[model samples]
Target: MSRNGQAFERYQKINDLFNRRKGEMAVVTTEEILQKFEISERQWRTDKQKLEELGAKFEYDGRLRGWRYIEPFNFSDNIPLTLEDMYNLRLAVATLAQLNHIADFKDLPQTVNKIRKAVGRWVDHEAQHKAIYFDPLPQYEGSRHLPFFLDAIEKEQQVQFDYFSFQAHQPQNYRFDPYFLRQHHQRWYVGGWSHDPNEGFIRTFPLERIEGEPIRTGKYIDFACKPKGFNPITYWQHVIGINRPARGLVEAVVLRFNRVQGKYFESQPFFQPYTILERTEDKLVVQMDLMIEIELIRKIASYGHEVLVLAPATLVEVMRSFFAKAAEQYTPR
Candidate 1:
């Protein structure tokens, strides 16, 4: 075989070894690879270099006496899925179907069956019967827009769609470069740079409120010069859910939850880096730094009386106004 062919064969075997032994044990030691592949130490070094180039994050640990994968990494483009990988994909599709209520990827079922057949494993009927499940919430209308928006993002093109505005009571035509698609509280959102000359800032559009299909404008965006500090995910990370604050400010929000509700948050926190200030039999006080948005108020209101906003006097007043209005609605006139 030519040198390139030999290198490709070596890389494939190395990838298979890594995939098979991943998480169960580490066969990443120099000595181990040398023994398993019957390669010289110099060749093993070359293989390690190639793996790193292909996006495998392998870090050497003196304590473990072997290299460990910092995260799950896969390099093969068209390789058959491992049994575990196929099973996880199946669970993911089922979960998406349950949650979104829209079959976004039309060929997902067929693709999954193909993966299962490729594995050629016996059907563990008992195991399959008692598998993963999801208590999915109601369907989001915008879920159907996922595929189109994704295609637009991939193609780096402009899209025009009819956006319905609840406040305006009419649908308006909007043209924008679809940059990112995100899910917030089970609702899908597409955000990107608006083509309107007057408004150059980023804007997010709710999928549910989209009036019709998104049409491609046949215009391309040169992402090679895409802004230096632009990251769609990072842009909304600090904001509460999907609402981007008009006057964006990240402030410390202290909340006190009742014991019952607090226990739920202990396992699944509202946001990461939440510091537990006080934990008692009756109440649990925690704090998180987040951007103030209307969605933040909605989230607190969802818990009703179980959660109380303890700090940032501005938020307290907002919550107070919210409750007073709520109280009036419940009160007899």
Candidate 2:
């Protein structure tokens, strides 16, 4: 094989070894790589150098005697797409196609076309003949304001918008210091510091509830004047979904799932800090460290009898009460 072909083959082998133990701290050791590929120490060092040149970062642990990725890195970014890669890109482009109708993503169709043109040759026409389907995008209001809010957040400016919340009797004008724009469950929300005396703290507002265009104030956000210990990036990390509780602490919420649900949860976890405590033939017990919030409770309720809360007496009672009220709705009058 040519030098470039040999290097690509080595890159593929290295990626496979790292991925086999995904999420583990220690990946393959230098000795293991040399033995597996039947290469010398010099060749291994040269391979590492080539990978680093392509933006892959690695750190060596003396105690573990293995290398760990400093950051999540993938060889796919630097390598040419394989047949499988082209198929995956097609699926991704199909998903992005759904966003083309949205005003905020108006340029997506053009971008998608560009991608399709670039990979058109590699795509499998026979596979394209097979009917692959995707659910139509749901019509969501206030998406047009996404760019407006995004610009304000980038500029660190204050904004004012008339909001009509479900709990309110009338629309209220709110002055906010735009900090972050987040999307949850297909709805856009702007999270920032509110100027209202009743809500003089960091909060999130649904863009769908905004009545009109948001007016951006010329004044810039004074980060020094922000509430103590506020970080836009880490604000919602400890919680599932949105709406961080005003006075909530992170708790280890334990749950037991039925065999069927356990398989699903194991494959696709609901949130981060997901760890399996115990596993049996019939049930799987898992733990997630999160702040108890309405969204968390709602998520648990969505699973119905498939899941059971095992720890934190407070969450157990909340789930019980939530089910009771839900059951009451179905009772005969």
Candidate 3:
């Protein structure tokens, strides 16, 4: 094969190795390539740089003691997904459908299926695992908030809305400092400051809860005033959910996992760098920070009796009151 053909094949194998052991250790050495592909070390380095120019990036970290790869780094870097890559994606999609997924689509299913079948059969649990990571969230069916928010975002203006909160029986007018339109699960949320007289500061409001036309400010304020170098996820690292992300310092959130359902809580945490508080033989006490979006926490709790709100007394009480009222329906009604 020509030099370019040989380099491309080597890149494919490298990508496959990294993808297979995602989040695990992967090593690349001159010896391995020379033995496996009958190529020299000089040739490999040249090809590695070529791949980097093609938008592939990997970093050498002395702490992990190995190189870390960022995959599919470019969808437009002159590198098309290979036939094998397409097959893997297709296989994943099929397996996800089997997992009681009630996914809906408008028109691309038939064509996507045809393309997938033309690739190849995916192996065993590989497809299933890939599916779990690759699924897309459902889109909003009727989103009226976008136009209003878009106008305000573009104009750098403030907005006021008639808001109806879940616990509040009556609607209230709220002027806000809208910063972001965050989408969690399948719903859209606005995170900003509320101009309430008593507790006048920032808060979050779901788009669906807004009752009337939004009043926009004709003024401008710099968004750079907030922490300029921050990831919302990392910034709110201890947040129990995304409904309300802690503005600055993280708060500790302790949760109790229900007996039968606690295992689900053990699956993937909302954030890393968290400590597992206490694990009795029967139940698990999982504690993290309370900087996550509140809506995210509620959605996780909606999994029925799997998880319980333990601390912050306020959140626990909120859940307690909600479930108490819900339980009343079963009391010989």
Candidate 4:
């Protein structure tokens, strides 16, 4: 009754009724609605008309055994935000209004309106918020797997897929007990346990290599469920890639990031799981004790003198052999 708008009292009653019924058909009994709002049955009709004007359709469905929201409702449009919420909304938009999505947030006009209303900011006539892109669209079919895999995580289920590991270069059957989904370097990946836990006696399957029809094996294994104990940051900690054994020999991987590159990395890189043990006089040191990726050698090669692969003789030799070939091509008379 003390809520902030003319229709606020009605708003609370309808939202409460829908929630109380736990998302079933939301039809409220007319008598209960009147008692809840402390209004007469005639006044209830007036309020219902007001709700209908705001894009809510409430129909009496005898079959549903209660009132239903019909098909859709636009709660964001009808509920106005407080002024404080406006600035908060702007900050959130500034931080996250990037990255391309399939359905196109551009087409989510309702979402746009909600943001505009929530911020109470200028919706038009000039520069407001715009989408930015740094990463290109993933050129494969599983680019859209982020959302679907997220659902599988919430449902605590297993999934089957036709997978292609970059190492293997061909697709194979994979049943994964998904642990978590993570983002690193603009790529989406599902991290999980598999009933086929050992790929070749020690490694696990990578989900990106997974392709084609993903069978939704919703049957959950309570004992094998891993999300409860899996900490993504520490799990990937000191981990070079998915193929490495979870527990093996830890190495001190040393590399430098100059002032500019250090900040660039801080802004973007998913560096967790890799412990940074030192910062030297002229550079920042990143150390991760994980299996060496032959590709990581090339990444260090591109950094040139800016990064040094100090210690770990095995990795240094690997980098040496790779760059030695490049140095051969640069011989000049």
Among all candidates shown, the one with the greatest lDDT = 2
Return the clash pairs for model 1, or none: 142-207
Q: What is the TM-score of each predicted model, taking all chains together?
A: 0.69, 0.73, 0.50, 0.56
| Candidate 3, run of 10 with poorest lDDT | 98-107
lDDT per residue for candidate 3 within 52-164, as digits (tens), equals: 77777777656655555666454233555666666667656665444232223333466555555555354344445654444564445325676678668667687888888
Model 1 per-residue lDDT tens digits across residues 1-333 = 767667777788877766666663564777888898899999888878878877877777786677767776676753445567667765664564454236675666676556445544533542458566566577566788888999988988888999888888788888788889988777889988776676666778889999867799875565543446888858877876776764668888999999999999898886788899999999999998888788788889989999999989999999999999999988986
Candidate 2 weakest lDDT stretch, 10 residues: 122-131
Residue 85 in candidate 4 has what lDDT? 62
Any runs in candidate 4 off by more than 4 Å, and if so which? 1-88, 94-100, 104-109, 125-140, 200-209, 221-229, 240-248, 256-298, 328-333
- Candidate 1: global Cα-lDDT? 0.78
lDDT of 2 by residue, 57-175 (tens): 88888877898777766887688766777778878887888788788787898998888887887446734584457777788787988989888888888889999999999999998
Q: Model 3 residue 31 lDDT?
A: 63
- Models, CA RMSD each: 10.5, 10.5, 11.8, 9.4
Return model 1's CA RMSD, one decimal: 10.5
* Regions of candidate 2 where Cα sits further than 4 Å from its true position: 1-80, 122-132, 227-229
**Alpha-carbon local distance difference test for all models:** 0.78, 0.85, 0.62, 0.62
Higher-ranked by TM-score: 2 or 4: 2
Model 3 lDDT, residue 174, Cα: 76
Clashes of each: 1, 0, 17, 8
Better of 3 and 4 by TM-score: 4
**What does candidate 3 score in Cα RMSD to the true structure?**
11.8
